[model samples]
Target: MLISLMGYSMSINLILILKAILILVLGYFAVKIVSSILENGAKKSKIPELVSEFVIKLFSAILYVFVILLAVGVFGVETGPIILGLSASLGLILGFGLQDTLTNLTSGLWIAVMKPLDKDETVQIGGITGKIVEVGIMATKLLTPDNVVITIPNKLVWGSPITNYTRMDLRRVDVAVGVSYGENLDNALSKALELISEHPKVLKDPAPAVVVTGLGESSVDLQLRAWTKTGDYWGVKGDLTKGIYEKYGKEGIEIPFPQMDIHVHKY
Candidate 1:
């Protein structure tokens, strides 16, 4: 009788093992089928690539967990207590060790959703200026004009002030030109205004304005303010400076230089 009982226990264990293996195999194919369906649906719906990728990954993780649970069930194992214990342990560890990571990830999600800056938008954040290349889950990548790559933490980006240079379709170019104290301020101002007006990239709606900003030590400070398309900003700025120099020279507008008089007394 004892031998018969031992034989029955062994048989039951073997059956359980086979059941577990069969469940795992079935789960594998189920997961594959679900993933394929998701991909097809996403493609038909014309979902954004990033959104589709995220959805697929999320579903895959869910399917993996389900497969594990099914395998455990096949062996007559209780999973409720195990799941509770795991959740508690994971929460405690993540709370302590991954606080900053979670913060960055949340902030990055917010930025992606809000889209404060788009790809290729020029932005200045955390004292670094560059064109946005990619915005990831924990950080943002930038490509500087000099071809340098900069990665900034999402927490810092969300916490600090961001200056988006290309936010507006048009921007104002602020240029300062100085002339001799005794020169005709009117003529200098008119000539500077003319130079700005003649630039093809400069906007005409707002109209360029020249004003006396202040009196410097050796020259009369004049500010030339003009509106230009954001795309043409750099070219217009550079050309405007050269144009100012040449035009002022032709108009006999003297650009004063800093000078100091030294006095020496011999006793």
Candidate 2:
């Protein structure tokens, strides 16, 4: 009779093991199928790739946790106490040790949702300027102009001010030009405007303007302001400065240098 009871117990244990294996296999396939469907839907919609990927990972993690719990239950294990114990342990550890990580995670979520800077946007955050490549759960990836990849933590990104250079379609290029005090201010202004108008990237609608911003000790400072598309900002700015110099030289407009007149009185 004792031998028969041991045989029965062994048979039940074997059945439970098989059931757990089957459940895990089925759970994996179910998770895959659901993930595929969601990904397909996301692709078809206007959702961003970053957001879609995050959603899939989050759902898959939850499903995996469920599968683990199911497998534990098959062996007649008390999952409630196990879960509670794990939760308490993790909570204590995470609360004390992972505060910064949790802050970064929360900030990343906010950034993903708010989208202050989108993918490929040129931004200067925390004194680092680069084009945004990926916004992840912990950090954001940037490709700098020098071809270096930079990773910035989400906590710092959220805490600092972000300057999105490409946020607006139009950007203003400010150029400063100085001329001799006796030089023709009106002629200099007209020549500057004419040169700015020649640039293809400079917008014609707003109309470029030249203003005498300051009267310096050596020369009069004139600020040339022009509007151009954000993409053409740097090129237009560089070209505009060069063009101004060339045109001024041709028109005999003197770009004055800083000079001070010193008088010495013999004691």
Candidate 3:
């Protein structure tokens, strides 16, 4: 009886206004709760944090709009047609305004899914060689060898070929050794093989090969093919080259240099 008397005392219009206000306040709080839950779910998915955060932010915005419409509808506002019309107009405007951004976003999605490259992997892409620091929805961050941070748009990165050096377990080092044409090819070949085998970093399983690749203007070019752990490739090449020079000088092997043999014609 008390509740009925209070309801009758409040004007019907005033009661509806109060109810609308209550719905709006509750909807605002609900939006926050739902946004928080969605953000938590995104984090749990274990994808890139930047991508997940972006996706969650977009989702929360749409949810907030839905909540606002629900609150408005409680006040006897016809929101369905308004919402549908506004959504189409807004979509068109946003699509045109954010065309470039959408391109990068789609490219980022492809990167996340295709995964041709990954974080912490050293790669050369789009003329930039560096270690991937972070892959975001708009751009990817890389730490270059010189310690400079480079941000490349995901669209450009996705369009280019990525060279991942660290992807392979082993790498082959090719060093060209030239000996005087007069030097015995057999002796030079043996010396090249010996130098490669003696190097601790060179993998003995491949059995370093020395072959006559070409004859240069002044020397017979010998190509030394050696396999080594990718990490040790440079070290092996440098150390073995030094060994070749020292060994050649000791064994009287000649490394030919540029010189022209002048033929004199006496008439």
Candidate 4:
């Protein structure tokens, strides 16, 4: 009878050990699979990379906790109360200590909901202009045209003025050009309009406009206004400036520069 009792006890101990091992091994792989599913779903749903990564990591962490609890149960240890106590303690501590962090997190959530600017879009916010690399949990990352990376806290971004250039299909380009006072205003206007119209990127629907906006101290200031695709705005504006410079040289239209007039006084 004693031998049979000892045999039963050994079998129970072995089963408990096996259960712990199985939970640990299976839980590890399970977390990986779930993380992969979440990644694919995020991609399919058009979620940003940073958001998807956060979700997957958070889910995996929660899953690991449960797996650990189950494994501890196999050893006859009660983990529920301990987990609750730790969670409460951590939450209280974090709530009291992480004011700015919490603000950033809340602001980030607000940004996600409002979506004033999206990933890969060009935007100017909080005195920074760049393409959005990621909208992270704590901050938004921007890649500048000069290849600089800027990480801005979500609170600042949410509170600041945001200018999203990519939000519209087209934008207007304005180039203020100046010609010598001796130049014919009508001829300069026609030539400026002609160059703007001939540019491949400039939109014809709005029609290019060349008007004398102001008379500067040195010359007659002509404003050349044109419409182009937002992506081509900078390129088209540069082209217009260069074309104006070349055309004026070819047609005897003098581009006036700042010069001081001096007169000699005889005493």
Candidate whose lDDT is highest: 2
lDDT string, candidate 3, 98-204, tens digits: 78788888898888777777788788998899998988778888999999999999999999998987778898888887999899989999988988887778888
Local error of candidate 1 at 260, Å? 4.0
- What's the TM-score of each model vs. the native? 0.74, 0.80, 0.65, 0.77
lDDT of 4 at 151: 96
The C-alpha local distance difference test score for the whole of candidate 1 amounts to 0.82
Clashing pairs in 1: none
Compared with the true structure, model 3 gives a TM-score of 0.65
Q: Write the per-residue lDDT of candidate 4 for residues 4-115, one digit (tens) a residue.
A: 3312322337778889999999999998898898888888997756556656766788899889888867765557776887799879877898788888877887787778
Q: Candidate 1 lDDT, tens digit per residue, 150-183? A: 9998899889899999989999888888999899
lDDT of 3: 0.81
Clashing pairs in 2: none
Model 3's number of clashes is 0
Please give, for residues 1-267, the per-residue lDDT of candidate 2 as tens digits.
122331232234667888999999999999999999999999999987777776687789889988988986776666787789789988998889988988887888788777788899999999999999988888999999999999999999989999999999999999998998999889989899888888888898788888899999888999889999998899988998898889999999999887678999999
Ten-residue region with minimum lDDT total, candidate 1: 1-10
lDDT of 2 at 223: 87
TM-score comparison, 1 vs 3, better candidate: 1
Q: Comparing 2 and 4 by lDDT, which wins?
A: 2
The candidate 3 region of ten consecutive residues with least summed lDDT is: 1-10
Off by over 4 Å in 4: 1-25, 42-61, 64-77, 261-267
Residue 56's lDDT in candidate 3: 66
